[model samples]
Target: MSLVWGFLALLYVSTDGLEPVPVALLAAFFTIFGAGMNVRLERSLERKGEYRPSRKTLALAILAGAGFLAVLFTGVIPALSRPIIGSFYLGIAVAWATRLILLWRWEAKTKRRIYVEGTWVGSFYLVPPGPLQPAPA
Candidate 1:
């Protein structure tokens, strides 16, 4: 991941030459950094018996990663804004999908069903079903 980001950074410097889209570049860096953090977090969770990667996780990872790549390479409704797309959009998408994959893995490991009953304002998680909690004004 670091290597990939490094290559991109080098390429960016060579091509754009002092471009002003710092946020987008930072997002790409963040995505790479976040991947390492995710690995460490999952290991810690496993040690705590809070989460475990399963086949479902593999499926989700493949699905999310491939979906993003498909959008990226296949150019299906591709982001025409070239600068923002590769750096900002892909970075955010991959990072977010990583988070979701972790959450889903945790739920799969814990036998917890996490979902909304309607609004997240009231009681939402539907496991061990009970009366819905009163909604806030």
Candidate 2:
């Protein structure tokens, strides 16, 4: 999901000639989309005592949102060109890429086996397989 978002963001930032306001709006939408999916995944993990993003992670998200809010409300971005806004989208793409790597590494280290309903971000668990019970596909 993050990879998809990152790719789309990069494509938009690099190829599109959208104004700063539209770029920022797209950024906001993508942020919400990814964050909501992440939150849903995290809550599922929390319910199963499997995982939770740390306070520092939450703080970083908050700070990023604040930065976007500043740009949205302050009218500073309107003066800037697409390159600047593109840079912001690029930053978001980078962040999502970093998050993907981290989540992959974390999953490897934790030895967790997640089972999702529809997608990787869907509700999942870490239950161990036992006798007479095959592992999830």
Worst 10 residues of 1 by lDDT: 117-126
* Local distance difference test, candidate 1: 0.51
Q: Per-residue CA lDDT of candidate 2, range 54-106, in tens?
A: 56766786687578657744667664464556556555665455445545654
Which pairs of residues collide in model 1? none
lDDT of 2: 0.57
lDDT of each: 0.51, 0.57
Q: lDDT score, residue 45, model 2?
A: 71
Per-residue C-alpha lDDT of model 1 across residues 1-137, encoded as one tens digit per residue: 42354346445434433335754576667677667756755565545533334567557756875675566556564344444444543455456566557657765666544453322111224243345533222
**Could you tell me the C-alpha RMSD of candidate 2 in Å?**
9.0
- Model 1 earns a TM-score of 0.36
